[model samples]
Structure formats: structure tokens, C-alpha cells
Target: MPFSARLFCRPPRAARSRRSLSTRISAGVTALGLAAVTAPALVLLAPAPQAAALPNGLAATPPMGWNDWNSFGCNVTEQKVKSVADFMVTSGLAAAGYSYVDIDDCWMSGSRDSGGHLVPDPAKFPDGISGTAAYVHSKGLKLGIYESAGTKTCAGYPGSLGHEQADANSFASWGVDLLKYDNCNGDGTSPQQRDTTMRDALARTGRSILYSLCEWGQDNVWTWGAGVGNMWRTTGDINDSFGSMLSIFHANVQLAAYAGPGGWNDPDMLEVGNGGMSFTEDRSEFSLWAEMAAPLIAGNDLPGSSAATLSLLGNRDVIAVDQDSLGKQGTQISSAGGLDVLTKPLANGDRAVVLFNENAGAATISTTAAAVGLPASSGYTLNNLWSHVKTTSSGAISATVPGHGSVMYRVSTGSSTTTGTTHPLVGASSNRCLDAFNNQTAPGTKIEIWDCNGGANQQVTSTASGELRLYGGTQCLDATGGGTSTGTAVELWTCNGGANQQWRLNADGSVTGVQSGLCLDVTGGDQASGNVNGTALELWTCNGGANQQWRLG
Candidate 1:
């Protein structure tokens, strides 16, 4: 079995939560949170209201690059930022998609100008933000600035509190492409109000700058972050320590459903290459971020970073998963003895799994394909992400993970489907999800695959009872009255939790009825796409046919 926040930022006392995650979870994840923490509710509310989708399409994936916070902090200056920008380009981080060179708190003047607009501290930046932005752009990297939603930034710089529009206009005039808005000194402001104000102001500037909400998840920002910014910090500031990184990962992993194309749940900046962690721990940090589909913004001094750190930041395969078009976050499937299995479904029928050993010494971890949401009948092509080694395996995958280290694998099921935690179940061979037969709800309707869309007919779910439940209640994929023979019709029927309704996801990528001992297969073994998309599905022999391979991402 495998499965897996304390905020330490300096701030007003009330902004801190006494909660230290004292509960030691004995088992695995249940629902959206750990079993023990569910009663009090870890996340306070539902996602931001539907109307709050903001920032248009920028920061669609986790923003990747380097920020000055973890390394230089308030010591960041014009030369320092420019040097990092140069390193990003020279070290191939920019070419590898790490574009934003951001300056965190303390980059601004202590007070706004007499005109009530933000002004960069000339002593530090030398060139104003506009000129700095131009230099960054000339190097093919984006420029990011920091400010607070409150009256003052954490480092005592003038915040954007009362000058939202004016400051927004100034940033746009300076060609800023990213904004990391913090929440310190926000006297009477709700995270929502302040973030929303800036969001509106950014839009007014007519520049598509990526808005980052740094509220530290105090106000249930995910419930409304989409309405405010492209990515929102889901945790407090991260220290360059394994414990700190682990706490943040736990707090944000289960919030996957709240993340998608336009908005993301940020776990804060990367601490890799920083001196606080061993290289093994650093790899674990990078692996976890990629697993969460979180931003890969490196926080180390790029110039001083070792070659190993650069390689970790530039691993195109791990980056691919973080930047996958599907934009789904990975969830922990199991946890025990400090070993965790987290799975992220990819754009194709591929799955990325990380076996993280959090113990003080090395540990052996194993996870069955089904546990990672892979069908039992299908074989997977696996690539050890860190080693760049590829292999194939069926049944289950296992590894001896180093202490405080991780092994990540990108697995492709050969076929693809959209049936995911909230999306429809797609038949790998059919390129569609299992839908209600003829779009019917009554019992005994033929279940088939159709082009996935808003129609509830295509939606499916995997339940604890092992039923392929249709979106609507009362109906599920049934075995046509306990039939076990090949070619038995699989139809929609009242969900009675009967053996005929019980299905086991197999290694062969087929759903087998526990009672019938047969696999779910497309009629006539159709691997053909297009017009025959809505082909009927039935119970058939598990002969490892392409039509029997089903995947849910």
C-alpha cells in the first residue's frame, strides 16, 4: 500500500493557523482530504464562483522560471535580476520553458510617488521597471514584479492596496508579464476583494499579465481563484527543507479538482538547488511539484546552482507532465510506512506515478496498476523519469526508493479516454467515454461510447463498489443479469450493487465483472475511430484485444 501544512511565514498573528496537521493518518486518502482531517474540513468552501474566471488564458500551466524570494530576497537588485535573467537564457532554462524572471518583495519604493503610483526603488533597480522589463524581454524572458494586496508588502514596500488601477497601469506601461501579489499588511481587506480588485485593474491595463494570488489559502482562494488570477498560492511560504516541502505538498495535493486550464493551485516556489536540502530531497521536491501540476518556478540562484540542479529544472519529460494540455493534478492513491503513490493522468491515455519514500532511510514501495487507476488487462510502457530508462510491465510496478527520494514514471496505456475523476470515461480504442446506451436512463439501455461533450450521456464514474456508474443516479453498467458467456450484452440498469454490476479494473485495461468473469469489450473489436464511435459495448473474452483496452485519465 502507498499513500501520502504548517505555514511559517512572518505575518500578523491572526493570519496564522495553529493547525500543525497533528493528525497522523494511518491509512490512505479518502474523499478530497485525508480521512482524519475530513470531519473539520481541510478546505473551507467550494471553488470560486463560476463568474470569477480571470486572466483569460495566460499561465494555463504552472508558471515556470526563477524568482528572487528564496535566494536574494530583499537583496535583489537590478544587477541581480538581470544576472538571473542572463543565467536563465544561458543555462537553457529559458529555452526549456522557464521564462519568467521575477523579483519578489522589497523591489518597490517604500512609498508611492506623489502621483499615487508605484515606483521602483531607483537605488536598487537603477533602471525603472519599464527598462528592466525591456531588458528581460530582450533576453526572451518575461519580467515579474511583486506587490502586496495590503497597505504594505512584507518587506515594508508600498503595496497596491489603495492604488489598484494606477499601479496596474504602471505595471502594464512597464511591460510586466507576471504579478506575484502577496497578502501581508492587508488591514481590512478580504483576500477575495483585494485579489479581485487587482484582477480588474490588470484587465484594465490591457496587458495579459499572469496574475498570481498569494493569499496563503487562508480564504479558501481555490473556491474563487479562477475568478481572480491564473494561479493562486495554496500554501504559505516554503523553506528549503524537506519537512516544509512535505507539509505544502500534503496540503495542496487533494485540491486537484480545483485546478485546470485557466487556473492552478500553487504550492509556492521551488526550493531545489538551495543549500537547505540534500540533492535527493531536492529531486523529491521537483518530482512532487511536477506531480501536482504546480508551477516549476525555481527559487535557487541559477548561477551558483550545480549542473545537477539545472538538469532537474530542465528535464523535459517531467516538464511535459507539468505542462500537459489536460491540466489535471495528480492525487495520492495510497500511503503507508512513509511510502506514497501519487498518480497524475496525462493528455493521452498515459499516467504519471511517483513512488515517494519519505522515510529516513531507503524503502521498498509497490503499487498495482489498478490502484493507480489503470485497468488490469492493459500493459503499460513505463519510463523512469529521473533515469530516462524505459521498460514495460503488467500487473504492478515496484521500486526501491531512496530515503527522502522519489521515482517517477510516465505510463501510456496505448489507448486514451476522458473518463477521469470528473471527466467522462474514455474507451482507449474508441476515443470516447462510456455513455448511456441511446442516452437512456431507464434500466436495460445499451451503454456505448460517443464523442465526449456536455451531454450527461457520456459521463461515467468508478465507485467504491466497483460499478461503472452513469452520471445520473439509479443506473449503471450491468452484466445483463449475471451472464458470464462471451458476447453477453452490457447494458444500463438500476444500480443494485449486484455481482453482475460489480466490475474489477484489470491489468489488461478491461473492466471485468466479478461475477461473470468476463471483460468489457467494444462490439466486433472495433479499433476504428470516427462514424462508428457510438459502438455498443458487451462482455467478451479477455484475449488482450485492442478493443478491450480501456483507460480513464
Candidate 2:
């Protein structure tokens, strides 16, 4: 339920296999691809190769922004780009985390300069890319430029194949923050080598640039992209059509395990505001992209976009899940007869569930909290992200999703872990209890220190499942992002029974995260500084300090 060639279009298919041997081979490849397409919920490819994450700290979450390819193609201009950047801020897109304004292709001159330096087309970009980038930066945004790995780009502009370092230098000098290195006009070399070459070249520039590989999923980019680029295209270009969007989703959804903090599996830029899809289909595209943790790069005419388009692009609550610090991409949990369910685990232990109906008519899709991996609870809170509607469910999560539409919810478990028995988790040095920010039961709410007032939000229950439940057992003290590193923020999230939510109450008055083995400490509060109310909690090295100690009674 879950869901090139030329213009990067392949040559017309050779005449269908005429010989028996050729027919068999053709059928075999078709069957393999069909399995991946139709059985998206369970199809698993052979394990991808293990690779280190790119050292670049950019894209700790999937990148959110806009690209010019899907809408403008080669008609991009500096004035159009500047206007979109202006709209990005004025329409609240930048505030909602859409930062990069990308120029897809054709921004370069038809030929390189006599000095061997790449040049922006003076006619298209009168002030040069550096000046345009300065203007974009002035508005608190970043600029992305596109190039190709081969001798020429998809549009036949000079590529970076033999000029990697020089082009990287030119880009860095122009203040480019992101590079969409495409797979057009390449030599016979492997994709990995070409992409990695650019990766190293970008590093040599000494600027933190996010590298995006547009290899069209050839060479199984996901297997090695983490070490080379921030995000790699897992499919061919996307068109402004429902059929095209659905096919891309099917191809990209099954590769979820390969995406994370430093690298993401890109399904290609979004076509949300394009005229081809209906409003419902557009919303479905946006929801599915966020659900899959794909980059939210808008590929529409932003300056001329309708109000509906702006609202869909600027939904912060939906964006939060895609940009969640956990960096886990959602996967299809169930798919049958065109009804699909996808679940993504958030940093605060909440699960984002999307019920999508791919059929021609609306249908009711159902799945339970337990099925989606939430801990058992007396009730579950379902916050409809698109509709902003709230509902309670004992366990089963169901909704009537419209045809070619999706209904997304931020689901949190509300069942008490224990039967009316709870105790306070008090800071050993501060003598203040752990409290949910503002007593809010929402996922991702900050966990802080507060006076021990016997409030339900401070009542903790050490459950058999290894979770320290609070908020009358609805919330858990979670290590943000499941991070095993020191200084990771601690928060109150819906109890999902994840390792990050598991804590050990040691005899030394310390509460240490089971995943990180780091003691919970009052942020910036030591014996000399004294812990105070509302101080945030974080995981720190276990140094036997009083600030790192806790008493659970």
C-alpha cells in the first residue's frame, strides 16, 4: 500500500526479444522489478553494502527546499530564482525550514570561460552566481547549483567529469551550499567513482557543502551513497502526474533502511503545485514524501503558487516528522488492494502513520497501535496532521482515506503503564522532579526539572518493558534521536518501548540511558551552579557528579 534516458530518456527499446534465450532473460528482469513494484510492503533487496556516513554534518535530517527543474526546467533565470527566494520567506516557507533555493540546470554558459573557469550565463544571471548567492544569503537562505558528472549536463552544458576540483572550487567561490551533481553525459567509469570524486573535490574546497548525487539509482547508490553524498536519487526524474508519482513511491519506499542522518534516499523533487495532479493527489504526494523522510524540495512555480500550495509546503507539524532528529525513514507496514500503511518512528518516540488509498474510490484503512509498534496503552491519541483533528482510539487506528489521497497522523500511546501506582523521579542535587514541559502530553515535548508537586505529569512508573513512564504513564523519558552520544537532549515522548526510552536506576542515585549508558544530567547545573526549575535534561558522561544523579521513589 505503500506505494531518464533522454532528457537522461533511454533509447527506444530494441525490438522485443526474438530468440528463446533472450526472451527468458527479459522476462526474468521484468519479474524481478515487478516484485519490487507490487510487493513494496515486504520485498527486500539483497543487503546494501555498509559504508560510513559522510563526514559533512549537513542534512542531519532530510533537506527541505525548492528546486527549479520540475517546473521551469532549462528556462531558469536569476530574476525568477531571486523572486522565488523572496516568496520562500514571504510565504512562510523559509520559516517552515525550506532553506535551499536550487537551480537545476542550464544556469551555466554554453561553454567554459577562456581561463578554464565555469561561468554563469551572463544573460540568465546578469550579476553572476556569486552575486545571486549573496542576495539569497542576505535573506537568510542558501543556494544550490546543478552540474553533471559527464562531459556535459543533461542539457549539454559543460559537466564536471574531468573538471571536478575546478568546478568544485568555482562553486565554493560562488557560495554554493548544495550541489545536485547529475548523472548526465558521463564517461564509462562507475557511478561510485564519479560521485566520490566530486565528494572529495567538494571537501577540498574547505566549505561545508551538501552533495546530492543524481545517479538515477544506478550502481545501487544507496549501498554506498552515505559515504559520498548527503542524498542520492533512488529513481529517475519525477513528472507532474499521479501515475508517475505513485511509481516513484513504489520504487523508493522499499529502500528505507538505507536512509539516515547523513544520507537519505531521494525519490526526486516534489511536483506538488504542478497542474497535472489534483489537489488531493498533491497533498498525498507531500504526505508520502514526509512519511518516507525524503527531501521536501518543492519543484513548482512558487511565486505564482496558490494558497493551497503554500499551505501544503509550509505544514510545520508534517515537516517536523520528516526533519525529525531520529532520521529514520518510514516504511510500508501493510499493503493490500491499494490500501497502504506506513509508519515512521520519531525522535520523541512517537510514530507517524500514513494511511494511503491508491484506488479510484475512497476506502477505510485500519491498523492498530500495537501493529505499528507502539507499546500497549489504554488509549492512543491520533493527531490528524492534514486536518488538524484529534481523536482517541483504544488500539485500532483507522481512517477513511480518499482515493489517490493520504491521511497522516502523529500517533501517541495514552494507556497507563501501571495501575494507579506512580512515584516521582527527583534530581539528587536539585531535589526537583522530572516534569513534562507545560504538562503537555504531546510527543517531542521538552522534559525539564520542576518543583515536586505530585502532579500527574511528574508521576513516573518504571514499567516491566524498561520504560520510565510519565504523564500518568502516557509519556516516556526518551533520549532524543536515540543518540548514544553525550549531550543528547532528553524529552518526554509517547511511550513506544524503544531502547532510547529505557533507563536504569542505579544504586549510585544515577539514572542512565540503556542505549547510551550516559547518566541523565540537569543541563548546565553542577554542584556550584545548583540545578533550578525548568532546566532541561540531557545525557552526559557518567562522572558520578550530583547533577547526574537521580532518585526514583
Ten consecutive residues with minimal summed lDDT in candidate 2?
3-12
lDDT for each residue of candidate 1 in 127-148, tens digit (9 for 90 to 100) = 9888889999999989999887
What is candidate 1's CA lDDT for residue 156? 61
TM-score of each: 0.68, 0.70
Best by lDDT: 2
Which portions of model 2 miss their true places by more than 4 Å? 1-44, 47-50, 415-553
Q: How high is the CA lDDT of each candidate model?
A: 0.74, 0.79
Per-residue lDDT, model 2, residue 237, is 54
lDDT of 1: 0.74
Q: In candidate 2, how many clashes are counted?
A: 10
Clashes of 1: 25
